[model samples]
Target: MTTVTEAVPPAPAKHRDQVATSLPPARGQSFLKLVTLELRKSVDTRSGRVLIAAILLLAVAAVGWQLTHLPRGTINFDGFLAAATSGPVMILPVIGVMAMTSEWTQRTALTTFTLSPRRIRVQLAKFVSAIVLGAVVTTGVVVLALAGTALGGATSGRATSYAGMGGEIAAGYLTVALNVVMAAAFGAVIAQTAVAILVFYIAPTAWRLAGPELFKDNANWLDVFGALGRIAERDLHGMLPETLTAIGVWIVLPTLVGLWASSRREVK
Candidate 1:
């Protein structure tokens, strides 16, 4: 009789388990990296580039016009800062809205959600990018204001007080940043660029116009425009409560709603 061949041995169950478990740890994108990507995306489009250029042009024109029209001694740093920032502040919110709505408007939501999966991170990245943009614009305003101030002083031989102007300027820029964020939140919730922009501008204006008649005793706390006006005036100490309430309503509430909508919306 022929001898039977030896049977082959199987791998140990523990060894199999070890092989299955041996995978590289999962790596996700960092917040800073996401912010950088978002910032690049904001300006990569043609519309974004045009908006930025237009903002710069408008800022320069505003400053130039003020210098030409206002009396030489009157063109102080504070006034110059306000004039320089007005154009950017008015339009920067539109940029924020575009950033938030571009994914849906451009039909890239599918790819974006697929790559990131967690939508909150994407929204947060957009928010951070908006803040960064606001800061950049604020810096530009500051530089322009300084230059204008120096020129006015040289031309008119007058010196203006720089005492409390710093705090006021900072508060004004911070309010602008907050407004950009609020617009982005609205954009995220609506997911439509035109609708979001319309609502962002119209709602505040309507509220400001009707708030006193409608809300009466509570307009100060309920009206975003009034609260932010106080903020722009640097009345932080006196109006802190009202400011917080307004921010909670306008920025915080919309942001929460946006996060909810973004998380649940189907990606097609």
Candidate 2:
């Protein structure tokens, strides 16, 4: 007897058992993910690789260059460090610009902000990550600097006081960190990397120049890099208050403005 057979429909998958889980990611986790991705890209890329190498190579090269220009007996370790480090400071800001600009150029920020929807969180992550990256790079520079010093046949230690060292390292890292934060913030404000980079390049110079000339003594309060230099040197040059003000303007103002802009802008 040919019996009619009933077709059975497939059962619905359990929530936990679904091959593709439907659980939403935690909010903070998404921000962390963004930071990790940025750092990873930086570490993996040829350009990022070149950054550290270039710093080291430049330090050594500066020592070589100094040998040619400096008097025979003037080739001291401290002098070598000053010469090597001076040129590299300009490069750090460029790095800050690149960090933010690359995101838009590569379209990575779209995916990043889309996932979290909390722009501040993403900004904070980038800021923190940039500080860490800068610290690591600076540490590498310091190592290379020490090596260069040793190669120069000098045995004296760092000239700055312990207190000075503390302040110097803190200020140096903070300066680089603030630059990164400014870039990230500016990126959000402008949304175009090219425009942001141009502003970053010009804004501080204008501020420093116009500040001192226009404001007189008040200019020291407004001079961004000059204040940073004082803080880094721990010179107790009565610029501490001004340096604090500059830090507030650079680090906090840009961050607030950026976050506001990011919150308002349409996600492209």
Candidate 3:
């Protein structure tokens, strides 16, 4: 007699397929999270605290000194903005460098890269955060400086127009924002905060003091710092093309290189 064999059940192949098809990290859990996380990390550290305090102090001092020492005339609040921005400009690159280099210096690069998987995203997040931070700080300072100048001018019976200062102050902030981006790019390219700071600090001073005789002919196009100084004058004066090009070179190129490098390098 032939015995009927029980039918064997088939495995759930569709369930396996569905598991395979499931997407990676949700769309909401991307770049912005990484940036916010990074910013938080930065704010929690002593170094970060010191750096921020220094920047604020410098801003306050620069404005205070200018208001007190500026030759009595129109009480140029715009001019004070220009002076105040100089401090932030000098520090912007250093801040960028610190943001990038700190990952390595603080031994967080490995964790950051591993979690993100896309190293470039991490680098870009740092960059965007730095730019935003710089712009916020610079703009806030400009507003404060204007208010302080207005109060002093009003009490002293001096001629200071907040309306007139608006354009110049805006230009000063724009300059600071641009420089912040450029500095972050440089830090990314260099992968070292110290070097980026040195380069950022020295390049402008050196160029102004020892530039070639033809410097005047090409200064409008080649000098990043000079562009800021010129722009602070608030006329544009046909310098936008040159300023844009210089920004691309000094900031964009380096940032791209750094992103590529960060993507390729082995996290430590």
Candidate 4:
């Protein structure tokens, strides 16, 4: 009995650090945190910084150009807002394109996807960040335009109109924001910065130019720019169906395709 009583040793317990490392993190990545990271990444690069600086400078230049060229009587808050918004709206889509495409172009997709395996969440963060950037740029443009309007009015003794301008400006902001988001979707689908940017600008312009000749009476329904134009003119109520159709074709379809592609595409 004594010879058979050999004691067994206890297994060594894993240290707390080893246990922690063995498991996934206790907290999952947060939406707000992802959005914040995306936003920061948007402008952290040299090109990103340049694009941002160019946007601000262009907005200022546009306001100044309008002041010098337009008659003082013609310079109003609404007009200023429109002109200032044009600068950023023209270029913000490129920023959107770069935002999504850079993940692959810069070879960071592997790291990004690895950290967050749910690619849709990453896509959503990029989309939300683009919207946030659009909103901020729009607000800045509006502020600058307001300052310009005040200066012009004070110096020239011209009357400024505040009535019925809010809706128009808001519509412009929304249209611009939608356009940016659409470009981001295009980038997500295309996965190439230059190609996405080119298609985003040229394809729309070409369609607008050729649609009337090619599609005849139905072109407007399929025209992305046309839908956006209706929005810019504050004619959403009148053209709601056509606008929705255009969005379905241009935005919704591409977004769905992009999400599908992103989900299955191998992360290199």
Per-residue lDDT of candidate 3, residues 210-267 (tens digit): 6545586666566666666666677657878987766676667777888887777667
Which candidate has the top score in TM-score?
4
lDDT of 3 at 146: 75
User: How would the candidate models be sorted by TM-score, starting from the highest?
Assistant: 4, 1, 3, 2
Assess every candidate by TM-score. Answer: 0.87, 0.77, 0.79, 0.89
- lDDT against the true structure, per candidate, is 0.84, 0.65, 0.72, 0.84
Off by over 4 Å in 1: 1-26, 72-75
User: How many Å off is the CA of 198 in candidate 2?
Assistant: 1.8
Q: Which is the winner by lDDT between candidate 1 and candidate 2?
A: 1
lDDT of 2 by residue, 1-268 (tens): 9999999876667744664566665445656677787677666767767875776677667767755564454334455556666756656555555565565667776786777667677666666666677767766665555565555544333232122334455666666666666666666567676788788778888988787678888877767788667755657486678888887787678778776776666655
In model 1, residue pairs whose N, Cα or C atoms come closer than 3 Å (at least 3 residues apart or on different chains), thus clashing, are none
The residue pairs that clash in candidate 4, if any, are none
Candidate number that wins on TM-score, 2 or 4: 4
The candidate maximizing lDDT is 4
Give the Å shift of residue 156 in candidate 2: 13
lDDT of 1 by residue, 1-268 (tens): 9999998899899999898889777899998988998899988999988988888788888888767766644446777777888888889888789888999999999998888887899889988898888678677777877777777767667775455677877897778888988999999899999999999999988887888898886787878887777778866657788889988999999989998898898887
